[model samples]
Target: MQKLLKLILTSRVYEAAAETPLEEAAGLSRTLDNRVLLKREDLQPIFSFKLRGAYNKIAHLTEEERARGVIAASAGNHAQGVAFSARKLGIRSVIVMPLTTPQIKVGAVEGYGAEVILHGDNYSEAADHCQQMVETTGMTFIHPFDDDLVIAGQGTVADELLRQSAGQMDAVFVPVGGGGLAAGVAGYLKALCPEIRVVGVEPADSDAMARSLAAGRRIRLDSVGIFADGVAVREVGHLTFDLCRRYLDEIIRVDTDELCSAIRSIYQDTRSIVEPAGALGVAGLKKYVRERKVSGRTLVAVNSGANMNFERLRYVAERTLIGEKQEALFAVTIPENPGSLRRFCSDVLGDRNITEFNYRLAGRERAHIFVGISIRNTGERHAFGQLLGEHGFDNIDLTDNELAKTHVRYMVGGRSPEAGHEVLYRFWFPERSGALVRFLGSMGENWNISLFHYRSQGGDYGRVLIGLEIPPKEEDGFREFLDRLGYRFVEESGNPVYRLFL
Candidate 1:
């Protein structure tokens, strides 16, 4: 590992100007009573640490191999790294990525002069296709962070960290995706500085590396939560796993909420928004310090990447507040009747924002509205429930319910045959600041006799499945106008599924 580190440090990619500042985070360090330093790889040229590996790998290639060209599979940062490095080396490169890769990232990859091939539905599928292309085309397959050369290049980050810190470090927190970054750093650090602790952080939803380490073997996950797309990997690389098993002190898991909070915190302190995977190290550091009651430890958190989607900022912002106990999700059940909605809003939820609401008369002896409320805090969650209980309504917390949060929000309402003449419809309203109440106020119940469903998708739009019973004697003009409301509505009043299911 030491020899590998030396080779990497002296390599072309690793020869870039070092001695980047590792500054103490005044706000966070004060909060934890431990000195916290941020290693700002987010500020790197490609907005990631991937450049180190990409350039190192390419720089070491034989002239003939370089002439043959190179290919890689990545959705964002790695693509940029390889493209930029190839451009710098005057070599041809192609990047294969999932079709769903963000438009901005795709553009960024192209901006680096690499031919971008959009294929597959996910990263693994793209990777497989890239491997097949390598076999057929004879192009050098640049395995991102997986190969010995790539890992050594990534290890150069630790070298820079140590060099800049003047060798004074207690612990270093690194993010784990395929384990390349962790393996590299841990391998070199364990070999050189046996006393320093090296911890790997991973998202709980995609913890292949951590799970593999625990099981003493590599295991692939069937599915992964792609919220942290950069780190939502199913399997650890073979070389990376071997190095990590031998050197890593521990691998800690953090949830999406905590990662989001860390993103917000970094933005607050450094004015930089990092992707979910990038924030894992800081989130893990927070967890580890509190859980172990560590004090006065000199810690360095690697801010891995900052290639965040602009649209996802809302989600990260909202979830971060929730993770910090500044927000809560509550199900407020109210009596189903005129003025009940207004009464609940004016009374219990007067100060709180209604992030979501779904009304249904599902087998209710007395009508009850199933409302999702986002409160100021957890105390307000309990208070709202107490208020509902006092009003003879059951307040169940469905905040954590997957179905309730996503699909249920939009799969609402259909008119029953008993309602002689009323059209029904559903829509996904935005889940922030008066959006719901404003939508309701805009659409008064002029003709209401049907079903409604709206679940949160952790997104702006909800997938609403609504059914409405149209008036038997409706005119063509009115029908055409109703159709112009721009919603995907299913007239299931006459359908057998509605008759049977509803």
Candidate 2:
């Protein structure tokens, strides 16, 4: 512990990294009724804190090691870090990125004079290929995390935080991915001031560290959600996990909606946009304060990065209101008679601002309507549902239904009773060109596609909701085909939103 602390204090990072300003989030503080400060790590030269560790690690390499060059594997920000740092040090760098990685990211690394190798489909696969190249080429592999020098370099963040805040903040929130930033911040903060709390935040779908800490061992996930692609590691690093376990007070997991909401809030506060993973600290901080109902305390969250893809803003904007409890969604059953829509507005809705309303007449007896309404607070959804029940309307609250939001809302008018033996699936396909063509081409000639909804978040993956009609006997064959295709998918035939909308 003492050795790590000493290394953190003496580690060289400022040679390439700048000391970012600690700014107060007055808008958020006003809303949450607490003092909120954001450590603006997003202001780094690479628009991420990753360069601090990447530069420091390369700087400390032996002269012979430098001559051999450096090789690293990353999907995005980390690759930029190593490439930028390596070029500054006049060392040749090889960055192995997923084949599905956007050309924009590839160009960024290449812009820094690094050789960008596009391989595999994702980070894990790229990392594996990177190891093979490292062995074949004998280049020094710079691990993104899990290295002593890298960890110490990241720990420099804590040193700056303490000095800037005068070591008086109540708790610090750090986003955890491979646990590099969290481990560094927690280790250094806890070592210097045992009383200061360090909390790590992770996406709920990608909480490998939380799962590992709970089991007292590292646990690799079968797969991870890619909305927040920056921190979507399937497993935490060994050294980082150990440091996090030793020093972090707790780890908080937040869903995608909450994360989007935090991004909106941070933008309001700082007029700066951060990526989904970048806002994890703010999201977790909001959750902590809401759950604990703490007030008048000095809470700080790290604005880790702002390397956001432009297209995801639409998704983030749409979900932000839902996350903030400003909007509620529902599916309601009502009489199919004339003037029923007017009656729903006058009798049930009664001046409630409707954000969205989708209606289709398919049945003579009843009509199922999907609706979104503005709400004053979270508790209003319960009252709205109760009012619908009391008014002789059968309604299901779809506020928390992911399928409803992601697919059903846009597909409310479709239903195919004639399409028998249909099964629904949600697939995460690589976003590269011809990936969809390959999926379609791979389908069996006998099988039929009945329903499809495709959404691309402009990241590593494109989400597709598809319904297929396959004979019962062909189920085994269909499963085999899906396995052979290698895309991550989940059977969604039983999802309630499918019945209600499609």
Candidate 3:
């Protein structure tokens, strides 16, 4: 490893990156009360530091080996790195990726003229399949992080940082997925400047390297939460792990929520959006700076990549406010009497909108309603729970229930669509002062609904499924109004079973 590292130090790859900038980040430095520098690998042509390793590896290949082409497996920046680097070197490259890899990344690899084979559902499975292909095709495998040359090439980032910083960095935070980037940077920095701290950051949901270091041996996770999919590897590579053991000072884990907030922060401060994996180093630095209170230290954080999917932004946006947004679900038992329901809605839930309501006469005197309500904060969750307790209502808080997320929202009752020629498809209007009375008013004076269901899709409107019986002559205008309002409806009025049941 030392000999390979020495060779890499003298290679053309190192020479190529000797002049990369390591300018100070005045904005972040002030925020942390420390002198801060950003290793802007996100500015690489492939938008990742992986290009350093990829280009170095391909450039070192002999003519005969280059003629045989190279193969690699990666679902994120590594794939783009290898593709772009191989194309730059005028060598053929084949990249194997998970079938579920985002279309954006797959297209990027193909755009670089690499033959992309989509296989497996995740990185490990894709990597396994690629290894099999390498053995069969006699093509040289350009590993994403495990090889000595790749690690050495990655180490060049540290060399550039030291040179640009005039050797003043007190600490550096590197993001760890399979540990290649962290190992490479840490290895080179520690080998040259033993006093400089090299810390590694990993997503809490997929901290295989951290867990492995704790266990004092390599351990593979059976499954990893892939919220930060680029770094959602189940295990660190063996070679990379060995390097990490030698050089890394400490491995810190940051939660998914922290990563999301960090993404938002980077966008706010720099107007640049980065994927969750790319934000790990920043997130870790924040936690470390606060916890350690290293106010005077000079810190560097590697901003890794920006391959964020636009669609995933919605989820990140939602989770960013989960603690602040009080979305609650409850199963409440109410009296079977009609007026009892009215009093509970008016007296107990004053101005609190019932997002969902469902009742069933389960061959008993009382009724049970699985209800959902929205609040402004988590504090309201306990407040609402106490309100039910005071009213003597049997209630269960199910805000975080998986089963409720899937099924409870659509449990409203209404009649069959086929029998009611005059079916009035009504949106569950949550704005009424006495929502229960409004619901009963819409149902009929004495008319009972045979079917009703409501559930939120985490959108502006909650979807409600309802079937109501009405006179045949009055249905057409109601149907038109429903269409005009853009509400989705399924008609069951014509079905024989609905007719018979009604």
Q: What lDDT score belongs to each candidate, Candidate 1 first?
A: 0.74, 0.91, 0.72
Model 3, range 1-502, lDDT digits (tens) per residue? Answer: 5775695576556433333456576777887899877777777777777888887888889999899899999988888888888887888999998765667778999999999998765566788999999999878899888877788788888878777877788889999988888888888888788899999999876899999998989889866655677787877888889889988999989876667767765676667787888888888887798778889889888888888778677667644533224457777777777687888888778888776666655534666666667787667887998999898887777665433433334543423335433342335333213444645644455343545655333222233545555555665755554555432344544533222222
Model 2 lDDT per residue over 57-136, tens place: 99999999999999999987889999989998999999999999988889988999999999888888899999999899
Worst 10 residues of 2 by lDDT: 409-418
User: Which segments of model 3 are wrong by more than 4 Å?
Assistant: 14-20, 321-502
- Higher-scoring candidate on lDDT, 2 or 3: 2
Worst 10 residues of 3 by lDDT: 424-433
Q: Which model scores highest in TM-score?
A: 2
What is the TM-score (0 to 1) of candidate 1?
Answer: 0.76
- Say which prediction, candidate 2 or candidate 3, comes out ahead on TM-score: 2
Model 2 misplaced regions, further than 4 Å? none
Residue 172 lDDT, candidate 2, scale 0-100: 97
- Quote the lDDT for 85 in model 2: 92
All candidates in order of lDDT, best leading = 2, 1, 3
